[model samples]
Target: MKRRSVLFSITFRSAVSSDGCKQSFIIRYTSAGRKKSEPSTPIHVTRKDSGELGDHLGNGHLGQSVHLPKRGSSNSNLGEDIDIPLNNPRTSSEPPRLKFTTTSRPLVTKILSSSDRHPSANCPNRVGAYTFGPGEDYLFSEDKVYIVKNDRIISSDSISKMFPSGPRHVNAAVYDQEREILVVIEEKSVYGYKRKGSDYKLESVYPKELPSSIAFTPNAAIRWHDKHQMLLSNGGMFALYDEYWNKSLMTGRSSSYFKNLPDRVRGISEWKNGKANIYTQSLVFIYDVARDNVAGEGVSVPDFLRC
Candidate 1:
């Protein structure tokens, strides 16, 4: 069966300037009909201030339109379409807009080397990485924090400088953009850092050990939810916690439609409308936060990520 196209929108903020002003842009795209021969997908990127649009051809070039292959096209590297709901509201009078932009090179080129392995590594993990805006990604590894810009590591700093006596092995980290704070999770504690001018200041710490219901692990994944709580998952179990380290709920696969699946959760990817994609070793499924249940059947992991 032919799957319907899905619209995706991404917004990016530029680094703060000396004067405290910042620039931002939006990228919108759709996985629609496909052509047979063309291998690249076209993306539209729009500047928020000027409303100017730029076309990004998947080949790392701008201002060109590229055709995308059909679904399940063996010749194409683009994976299957995921039906993500567009969160931005639009009126009937305005036409739909699509935009796109990406780093010039892949972001994992340097971090995936065999010699650079760390104890915190987990399959399909994104624990210590957070993207604050376009071309800005912060990676927490061991006692160091690296800043990546335009797919390249620009600078790094000792974790101690950001959070005095911080954990040497960060299990999970996330940046709350709305609150302008960085949250770090270690073995049994959570720390929060408020963004200062060009640095971070330790603001709060939860010294209490985490409950057994959602204990920290190398394989754990966390994302800040819009409802002001952290959504965390490990193996097949999921839990929610507030800033005070209070656990409000605990759930597992046995309570959802995916109960028959294995109890191995590789990672969690947040999406719009209080929904998230839970990735296992071989399959990916949707989880709805509002319903606290699996929303759909599982799909095979994309071929690109299998590598």
Candidate 2:
């Protein structure tokens, strides 16, 4: 019995960069359940359209679509087509250096200031607002006093940057990754930015209370969970807000030594399988939102973790 089939579908995958060199390679497959690869080398095509190695296609080993360069091509310009390896076999025991290269388009960025000196136009001491961009791009924007900003976007392409504008400094800001919405807490109101194509639209604004001193650290206390829920704290009391930005989905107080000061939100998360956990003060509030009720009574936190 004999069967014929087209088994080749070639796709070029870029090599990762290290230091000043990139490792380009060609892949070979085998029936032994192993992948074989060799460094891609430039070839000066001969009249036969072959490389240093002979016509590597005699047995139809390479697919029919594989096209070799036509003759008269000089590989002297190989450096322009391939990245050279960084390590010199003769010396340099150090690790390979890194190089920056990306296959994607660039983002946008805005820099507000760069100084922390006395009475300068840049680098103010206070932070009024901060938020990340849509599409999970590594761009972040911040607002400050006098409406100054030093925005930045982390990206592989040097061009990936962002400049998201709105009201002045925000007390706190949270990004809803799933829905691509930005929720910002301000001195007197909460604002929501909905992602529409490359820009954000102010969809909702809930006027209520915002704490005067909600300094955003690496670990922000307020967060978005589920489809339309947010867990927030003043430094002591905790509450859940829905997407409307109009009313509290629910509110709860912390029974701890921190009751006198403003309540702070510690954490908020909901698993894909529907389990939810909200951490604040010394307790964890688990909720089953499908039922709109607490999953269980207040549970004690473990000592190993600091809420």
TM-score of each: 0.39, 0.31
lDDT of 2: 0.39
Show model 1 residue runs off by greater than 4 Å. 1-135, 150-152, 204-206, 212-218, 224-234, 254-307
Candidate 1 to truth, TM: 0.39
lDDT of each: 0.48, 0.39
Give one digit per residue, the lDDT tens place, for model 2 in 136-252: 422112443221122211121111122244545445556666666666654445566776776556764433454433222212324433344444444345445544534454555
* TM value for model 2: 0.31
RMSD of 1: 36.2
Candidate 2 has its poorest 10 consecutive residues by lDDT at 152-161
Could you give candidate 1's per-residue lDDT for residues 1-307 as a string of tens digits? 6555533222122222344443222222334554223212323233332322222211132233434444545543233332222233232434667888985976564344543333332222232433232235555555676554433345667667756656665655655555665666676676777766776667755444566666544344445344444434454445555555445475444335233333455444545687666555456567776776677787654221221
After superposition, the stretches of candidate 2 with alpha carbons farther than 4 Å from their true spots are 1-134, 137-165, 176-180, 204-221, 224-228, 254-307
